[model samples]
Target: MNIQELLVTGTRLLKEKEIPTPRLDSEVLLANRLSKDRVYFLSHGDERVLPEVERSFLQDIQRRSRLEPVAYITGKKEFMGLELEVDPHVLIPRPDTEILVEAAMDMLKEKTGFVHVLDIGTGSGAIAISLTRYLPQVKVTAVDIDPHALKTAKKNADKMGVADRIQFVWSDCFQNVEGIFDAIVSNPPYIDREEMKGLDANVVEFEPVKALYGGEDGLDFYREIARQAPGHLKKGGSSSLRSGVPRPRRSEGSWKKSVLDP
Candidate 1:
């Protein structure tokens, strides 16, 4: 079908499936598939899509209709202007996460020396990669419990050119991580059972549960991180936990500040 016709049909299908931002979603999926800018569709409105490409594109649309994330379908996501590879085994990096990274940077900006950082549950290695990218003087060790997620994070680190700087460790919280860090940063799963039920169908159905649900009280990871931060951090080092407060609603990515010095 032609560009206009394909977009119209795809948008209609997604709208019927109750997908939010149907037009934007259709545009991104098609453009990313074709390796063209979103504006390409408007410029080539009458151009026809190949039958095979159309089939693939339509399959992606159907997946989104089922509430599967667009980032997972595309296998890529942008965080802090860095394009990182992603998959279902890891959670897609969110914009709010950049805040935590920025917070860490702000605190470390004036060190005038090398520092060690620990990134917990380092899915896709966004935070670790960003820190290493911007702070060449510093070294990072990223830890994740899931083997699959750690593999995904390592792949991203390699692609982002910081694989050598990050040490990937398989650890449940801090059970296996060793040594002291200048700071500990983590965005662990913090959803309770009640919060899980209210998450968007996309998150609840498609995202990994262990990466989202904290425990019965949602503060399980926080408490665990808090319990371990002291033993693992150097003097003046603090743990930054990405707050999962205000439940699973739209305003969810806000950081809840917790300062612990050891």
Candidate 2:
């Protein structure tokens, strides 16, 4: 079958299955099977796909039809122009969290001496590694409660050639963590248990539940971080909370919360 025919069929199948971005997903799957870029597929739509290529494309379509994320099928995701290896072990890096990184960068701008950063629940090591890549001289330490997540994050750090610059720790929150940091940043799980039922099937069924559900009220991790952060933050440092309302705790009284300027 030619690329055009395959794309049309794939799109129809995906649409029938109620998948979002059907055409784009079909194009990406086909291009991957052909070892070509989406632009190449567009330019060479008339080119015939080999029998083996057609089979592979069909397999990918079947996976997508079952609501598997395209990134999981492709084994890679683009974040901040960096190609990151992804798997079921870690949550996929997202664009919205780039705002957290931007906020961290802005906070780092006014400081002169060496900066230390702690990334809690460091799935995929995206935050820590990106900070290390951009800042270069900053010291980064990332902790993940899940060992599998830590492994995946370490692989990404090594692939990106920044493994030596960031430290990976296995711990539940700050249980095993030590040392003061210039900044602590995290995009921890904040989805409430009650809200899980409303999430997409792909997310609720396929993505790691431990990485998504943040307990009954979704403020468990945030509250813990806020309570423990001051002990690890340098005197003039800051902790950047991405989203969600942190449950108030008595231990967080020493730290002042400042709203970042937009």
Candidate 3:
């Protein structure tokens, strides 16, 4: 089938399967299968897809229909303008998390010389890598509870050319972390236990559970991070946390609770 026909059929099939973002998913998957960018779809929609290429594209769509994240199928997610490699072992970084990254950037604007950040529960190292990308003099020590997740983060750091600036630590929150930091950033799991059942299948079924659930109240990671961060942070150091909370309410309430105690 030709490019236009293939995208049309794929979009229809995904829509029928109740996949959200069907058209976008179809376009991305088809473009990836053809070893082209999404622009290729718009520019060459009428070009014929090879029989073998079509088969591969269809298989990717089937995985998406089964509720697997498109990022998992594509094996890459663009975060903070950097493409990060992701797998089932680590949580895919989201756009909401970018808020915390920007907050940290703003906090560090006036600081200089040997700045450090401690990224607790650093999954794919998106925050740490992005920070190093923007701040040439900053050092980031990224900690993760899961060794596999640390491996994934290191891979991403290398891919983004920030491997030298990031120190990957295997720790449960702050357990093994060392030194004080100018800032601490985290996007820890904050989904409540009961709320897990209500998440869309793309997340509940495919994303890592350890990276999604945060105990019955959804405050476990926040509590733990706040409890331990004080010892690892420099005096007056800041904490930038990203979660499900709305930005304003979080800055006024939950975030204050999580950081003050530390």
Best by lDDT: 3
Candidate 1 local Cα displacement, residue 82, angstroms: 1.1
Cα lDDT tens digits, model 3, 138-187, are 89999999999999999988888899999999998888887888899999
Query: Of models 1 and 2, which has the larger lDDT?
Result: 1
For candidate 3, list the clashing residue pairs, or say none.
none
The alpha-carbon deviation from the true structure for residue 100 of candidate 3, after best TM-score superposition, in angstroms, is 1.0
The model with the greater lDDT, 1 or 3, is: 3
Sorted by TM-score, highest first, which candidate order results?
3, 1, 2
Candidate 2 lDDT score at position 202: 86
Off by over 4 Å in 1: 247-262
- Candidate 2 — which residues are off by over 4 angstroms? 244-262
Candidate 2 similarity to native, TM-score: 0.91
True-structure RMSD for candidate 2: 4.0
lDDT of 1 at 98: 93
Local error of candidate 2 at 228, Å?
0.5
Residue pairs clashing in model 1 are: none
